[model samples]
Each structure stands twice: as C-alpha cells, then as structure tokens.
Target: MTILQPFSKLLKTIEPLWKIHFEPRVPAEELAKSRTAGSIPSFGFFFLLTLASIIATLGLITNSSAVIIGAMIVAPLMNPILSLSFATATGNWALFLRSGLTIVLGSFLAMGVAFLVTVLSPWDVVGSELLSRTRPTMLDLGIAIAAGAAGAFSLTRMSIASSIAGVAIAVALVPPLCVVGIGLAGGSAMTGVFGNFYVTNLDVAGGASLLFLANLIGITISACLVFVLQSYGSLRKALKSLALGLLVALMLSRPLGTSLHEFAVDNRVQLELHGLHRDGRFRDVNLIHRVDTKLVNGVAYVNIFGAANEEFIEDQKNIDNLDQRIFNAIQPMGVHTMHIAIRIAPIEIFEYRNTSSSYSYQP
Candidate 1:
C-alpha cells in the first residue's frame, strides 16, 4: 500500500487529460437517463436493427459500399453496446445483463432477417464487400477501439452525441452479422486466403461471425476503459468484462497477424511486378493489365496478365524467359513457394480513318 502512494497521486493529477473535457459536462442524472434509455427493451430498437440488417444484406449482395454505410448509420446496435460498457463500469448487474441480452438478441435478429432476405433473393453471389468482412485484422481491431473511445466520450457530451453517426461508420457493428447470415444461406464453404494460416472448409457465415465477435469485444473493452477514465466507474468493478474482452482479442491475434503479413506480401509482389513493367524489357508492352496474388496454405499463387502488340505476344522464347525472370525476382524477396502464370494477349490500338469514319487497328 505504501509503495503505490506516488502512482495514485500521479493518476489523480493527470485525470483531466484522460477525461477529455471532464465530468459535469453532462450531469450525472442526464447521463444515467441516457444509459437507461439505451438499455430499455423497446420495439424501436428491434425495428431499426432489423431494417439495418435487411439493408446491409442487400447492400452486400449487390456489392454496394454506399448502401452498407447507410445501414451502419441506421443501426441501433451501438447504443446497447455503449450501455454494456457503462453497466460494467458502474457494477450495475441488472443493467449489465439487460444490455448484454439485448446485444445477443439483436445480433440473432439481424442474422435472421438477413437469412430470410437471402433465401428469398435469387442472387447469391458472394461479392467483394461481403468477402472483406469475412476477414478481420489487427487494423480492424484498432479502428474499433478508437471508435469506441470516441463514442463513449461523445455520449457524455450532449452537443457531440449527434456525431456518433461517424462512429457507427468507423466501428462497423452490423454488416458482419448480416454477412454471417448470407454465408449460412448459401451452405457452401467460404475460403479466405492469408499466409500459412488460411481458412478453408468453413462456411462464410462462420468466418463473418469471427469478425463480428472481434468488433464486439474490441468496442466493449475500449468503451469500458474510456468510461473508467471519465470517472464513471471503478476499474476494479469492470475487470471481469475487460478481462474477457482482452482474452478474445488475444485469441484473435494469431489469424489477424497472419492476415497482416499476407497483405504485406501481396503489396510487395505487386511492387516487384510494377518494377518489371517499368524495366522496358517486355518489348513494347508498357502496361501491366492485371496482377492477382493469393497466398494459400504456404503457397503464393500469382496470375499475371498483360496486353501487348501481336509481335510481342508471338515470341514464345520471350514469354518463357519473362516467366523465369518473374520467378527469380520474387524468390529473392523470400517467396520460395509460388506459382506464376503469365498470359499475354494482343492489344488492338484503334484509329479513326478520315476517309470513311471507320475505325482501323494499328499494329
């Protein structure tokens, strides 16, 4: 106890910086009312969550990012999560359980709505937006933590609460759950390629659920920390929930780390390909048409497509030598096991003829 005196005094001195405008910004009574309102089991909450789920599901199905962002804005899911953090901070058991139950029920309700909509719709294709949420990285966790802190701080300042819409955009609480439903609706395996730790044989729904779980835990933990700093509750009271959140984050770290590493490898491979394009060795093939790289189960799969003049595409030896050079280039970058497939197709350069206004190919 005697050893902790200096630290205790130090914390008291720096509490203002941590609070970010401090208490009495919103009175205790009004704050309690806000939290209670969030925790209430109301028809409005369900309506908003269900509607948001439907919109997000359709948005993901159509690969529309704007629609998904709109869904994020309309989601009521953030309020209950914020309330959960507040309950944990204050050691309010009834409020904690009530908020938790609301979150769980809301998640399932969203999923149910998504599943029903997916089943009714004929277009079951998995779009890029849907695939993105199926993979979560440390970057996503970082965003959720920052957004949670911003959200909690906003809640205490009535004037700033309206800006919480931006927090909804940052945290992304609803889309993942809706993705889970879409995955389940298809009943097929959804594979995500990362480094050696790629996920296969798992359905999309299961993969998306992992992302949702990560976001939920990240937001809850960060919100609790912010509330504690604001003098809303004792750190001791929120320990168990915080511990659980940290444990989940720790468990998620392995896959998230693998994804980050894979992303780096992907970028490096693209840069090397760009260097090859700039070297002018391709005989008038000045542009790289497409480069696709996927790392799966310790192997990198590279598909390179280029457009060139007919003469350039006709050289069999050049194609073979170029393939060997690409293989050699990536090898120096620590990519030992990779398969590079190159496809060169003729690009017809068109010019309008003045005589007949007809288009003719040049070279």
Candidate 2:
C-alpha cells in the first residue's frame, strides 16, 4: 500500500496532461463506427480501387511519377488498412475479420484490374518506376511506419484529415500491388550484365508482392501504436496483436537490411565512378552517358558508357590506365574484387568553311 501511493500520485499528476494533449479529439466509438463503415465492400469502394489500379499500372508502364501520385490519391485501399489497424488496437474481432477480408478482396481485385489493363494495352514497357518498387529496403519500411502514424493521427483530428491523401501517396498502398499484377502480365525474364558479372532473371511479381506485404505489416504496427497512444484503445488489450506484428516485422527486416546494404554499396560505387569522371585523368571525356553497378558474390562489377575525344578513345594505354584508376578508386570501399567495362564513343567535330556567298549545287 505504501509503495502504490507514489505511483498513484504520479498518475494523478500526469492524467490531466495526457487527456489534454494525447487524447484523441474524436470519440473512440465514433471513430470506430466510421472506420467500420469504410471497411465494408461496396460498389463505390471496388470502383475506385479498380480505376486507381488501372491508372497506377499505366503510370508505371509509362514511367510517370505524377500519374502514379494521382492514382495514390484516388486509391481507396488505405481506408481498409487503417480499419484493420484500428481493429487490432481495440480488439474488435468483428471489425478485424471484416477489414481483413476486405483488404484481401480489394488487393486481389486491384491486381486483377492491373493485370487486365496491362494485357490489353499495346505498350509492353517496363519502366524504372515499376522496377524501383521491386526491391524494397528497410527505408521503405520506415516510410510506411511514418505514414501510418501520420494517417492515424490525422484521423483523430478532423482539421488535418485532408493530409491523409499525402499519407496515401507516401505509403503507396496500391501502386506496389498493381506492380505485382503488371509484373505477372508483361514481365519477362531479363538479365543484367555488368562486365564479366551478370544477374539471373528476376521474379518481378514475387519481389513486388514482398514490398506490398512489408508496407501492410509496417502500416498496421505503427497505426496500432498511434491508436493506443491516443487513448483510442488500451495498450494491454493491443499487446498480443502488436507482438505478432513485431514478429513479422523482425523477419522482414533481415531481407530488407540485406537489400539496404546492397543499395548503399551500389550508391557508393556509382559515386566513386562519377568522381573518376570528374578527375584530371579523364579530362578528355566529354560526358558520362551511363554508369551501372552490380554486386555479385561480394564482387563489384561496373559498366561505364561515355563520350570521349577521338584522341582519348584511340589510346589503348590511356584506357588501360583509366581502368586501373577505377579499380584503385573503388578498392578502398571494401570491394576486394571488381570487374570494369568501359565503352567510349568518340566525339568527332567537323567544320566546313562557307567561303561562297551564294550556295550552288551540281548533281
């Protein structure tokens, strides 16, 4: 009894501040009702989801970020996801089941729609925007978590409700799933060759599906935390759900961490290669057309395509020296073994003197 007195007094002191600041502006019951209604599968919901999926698929095919953003704004997928998070927080078994089913149904519907669109379209192009979603890193998890928190917080305050669109765009719930369908429909077995190294054909659908799963798990966990913090649900009740989410997130982090490492290494290699181009040794190089870096079995393989003066292009010794310099530049970055391939196109200049005032042509 004596030990409990201090804790009781501390709670009394903190209760007012908690209610004033941390408590949600909207009533918990009201918010739950709203989310429950939104989670129901209706014509409107499927219609918007279908349109959003088609738009997203087309945007990905065309490599238009702006169009993709528009699809994100129009997507109705976020609501069901938020509903699921709310269900987890409040321990509403009925809402939980409903939201889960809705999410699954909506996901497949969007994928089907995207697949159909991709199949019917005349253009069979896979753009960078689409491929970018295939390799998700821990960085994507962080974004999903942050977006989930922001989305939950905004829902509790009506004034900031409009920001949910931005949250949708940030997390990108539909685009990745659409990419899955697009990958299944039009994706081909493609190989990336860098110098002597090459990557096997990638499973585009599998990678994009993993990205969607990551986003789903990340958003659910973070939103549940936000809901509990805002007093919309009890932490004790949400513990089991949160625990399961954490378990999945932990499993996901392993692959995501590996991907993050690869991305960092690739970026480092690209920067080093770019630095080589700016150095005095490559002064004759006019412009770098492209630089591609790939890591295979702990070895870095770099491919460089650039335009250089005729003199530099013809000099075998200078080219060999440049290759050696590239190896030296990237060696310190923990890359013990590397292969480099350089393709330089000569930049030829032709000058014609117009000595005659009037032009005359004889055929």
Candidate 3:
C-alpha cells in the first residue's frame, strides 16, 4: 500500500526477469566450510585480539588515535558483524545466533579484558577518544545506517573487504566500550557521556553501541531485501522474515528510535530558523554551520551556528552579560540549560573627528 512496498515490488520484478542467468545464491554449504578453520581460536590469535583490544582501550583512554587504530586491526569483531549479515541472508538461524552471540559476547570479553588491563596498568587518564562516545545523536545513527548498507552491498558483490573492514572499525564498537570501562575505572563525571549529560561515557557507549547495532540492522535489512530479490525465498516467507527481523532490529535500536523522534522535531526547528534568519534581526548575518541536534539526559540539545555575533550582542559591555543573550535565544525552546559554542571577534574601538565640510576623518 505504501510507496515503499510498491517500489520493492518493482525491484522484485527485475529478479524474475534476470533469474535465468544469475547463479543460485551460492549454496549455503560452501560458505560453512570456512567455519571450522576458525573453530579453535588459536591461543595466539585469541591472546592477540584480547591484548589488542586492551591496548586500544588504553589508547582511547589516553586519547591516542594511533593506538586505537592498532587495536582495530587486531580486533576480530568485524568477521562476526559480517557473519551476522551472512547468516541472516541464508536463514541460517544457527549461524545467525552464533555470529550475534560472538559479537555480543566478544564485545563483553573485549571490554572485560580491556578493563582488567586498565585496572592493573599505571596510566589513569580519560581522553578524547573516551570522551567522544558519551553522546548518541542523529549523526552517529546516520553513520551506522550508511555503513550497514555498505557492508551488505559489499558482501553481496564480494569486493574490496579491507575497505569494508575499515568501515566496520569506524562504526567503532571496541574503542567506545573501552572508554566506558575507563570512565568507570577513573570514576570520572559520567554525566554527559553515559549517565545523563550530553557527552557522558554512557552517551558515547550507548550511541556507539547503537551505531553498531544500526549497522548490523541496516545490513540485515539490505540482505533481506536482496535475498527476497534473489529468490532467497518466496514472497510470503520473505515478508515474514523481514517482518520478524525488522521487529528485532527495532528493539536493538531503542536509543536510535528516540533520536529519530528528536530528529523529526529538530527538522521542524530548522524550518522555523529560516524565518528567524530572514528577519535580519539576526543582524544581516549568515549561518556558518550548526549542529542541528544533540542529546542530553535523553532529550535534544540543538544548536545553530550563524555568522553574526552582534545580532546577539550590542556593545563591548554586553559580553559580560553573554549568559542573558544565550538564555533569550534558547528560552523559547524550554531548554533548561544549553551550551553555545559561539565564535566572536571583539569590535575595535576608535574615536572619530570630522574636520571639514567634505568630512575628513581622524581616529
């Protein structure tokens, strides 16, 4: 009934049209052969991934990009995330659950192992990599959704996996969890990132974890659609599978669902901002950029960047009362407390003298 259903139907027609030529969705058996190869996690690889996750956590806590990247390479998590999509496509519930549990349990394993190392180790600082995970917003959701699609598509085509692996890292599951444990270990203010504030470790951890889930969910959606198209199953079966999978995906994305609601509201806020900007009461200014939405205590804390500072300020003395100006801009939104990352340059002061009819000037 919806536009999307019809569009999906139209795409399905292409499969029937081309079904004569394409190879049957590679038999599920061939794929499983590789499973046994990785069955007994060699002590070396196990310790390597475990050790790497720990070092990466340490790197994140120290805000070290280089260190964190090293951890990503050593991370064996990507295989499971991809395997999750693979198993979902084939309707192999065993593999699906196996991969899913591998990811979930592996994540816990990585975090626990990393925490033990951090707890015992000497360094005791929480860095930016740790700080970055403390918020979940539209942006983080978007990244995961996009990456999920990419991962599924790449799997379908079997092309360029290293790049896809990098993207898996970018969704960045391991690092943020490491950061969360570090925050707990340090007993830092968890408000913004995780507990209640904008950039708390919880915020970042929840957001990043949600992002990972979104990627997995997104990949599954794409995989399901592809399976349906490829005669992965009959229409009735596909629909049932899709419905069931979507239901589960939705549950995994509770934080993402809230963000979507906030984002819809944020969109309306943008529509109103145009009128605010056009009125020129904002001082003939133009916007530079703005973070249209953010999360704080599970609500939106949106910001818009505009070019004019004077629109919000009248004189040098006004700088002293900047809080009032910020309050006035945000008061209408019922924002209890908001932070403005505004940029301004002080106006140069000069006294002028008019000397003649032609008005020769001096300062």
Best by lDDT: 2
Residue 215's lDDT in candidate 3: 55
| Tens-digit lDDT track of model 3 for 162-265 | 56666656667667667655555545444322111143233444454555555555655664565446554445644555677679776866766666655655
CA lDDT for candidate 3:
0.57
Query: Tens digits of per-residue lDDT for model 2 on 308-356?
Result: 7899888898878877777776677667888888877778766798887
* TM-score for candidate 1, residues paired by index: 0.78
TM-score of 3: 0.60
User: Against the true structure, what is each candidate's TM-score?
Assistant: 0.78, 0.81, 0.60
Please provide the root mean square deviation of candidate 2 (C-alpha atoms, Å): 7.4
State the displacement of the C-alpha of residue 179, model 2, in Å, after optimal TM-score superposition: 1.2
* Per-prediction tally of clashes: 0, 0, 20
Instruction: Give per-residue CA lDDT, model 1, range 127-190, as digits (tens).
Output: 6688788767788888888998999999887778888999999988899999988888867644
In model 2, the runs with Cα more than 4 Å from the true position are 1-24, 189-202, 284-297, 301-334, 339-363
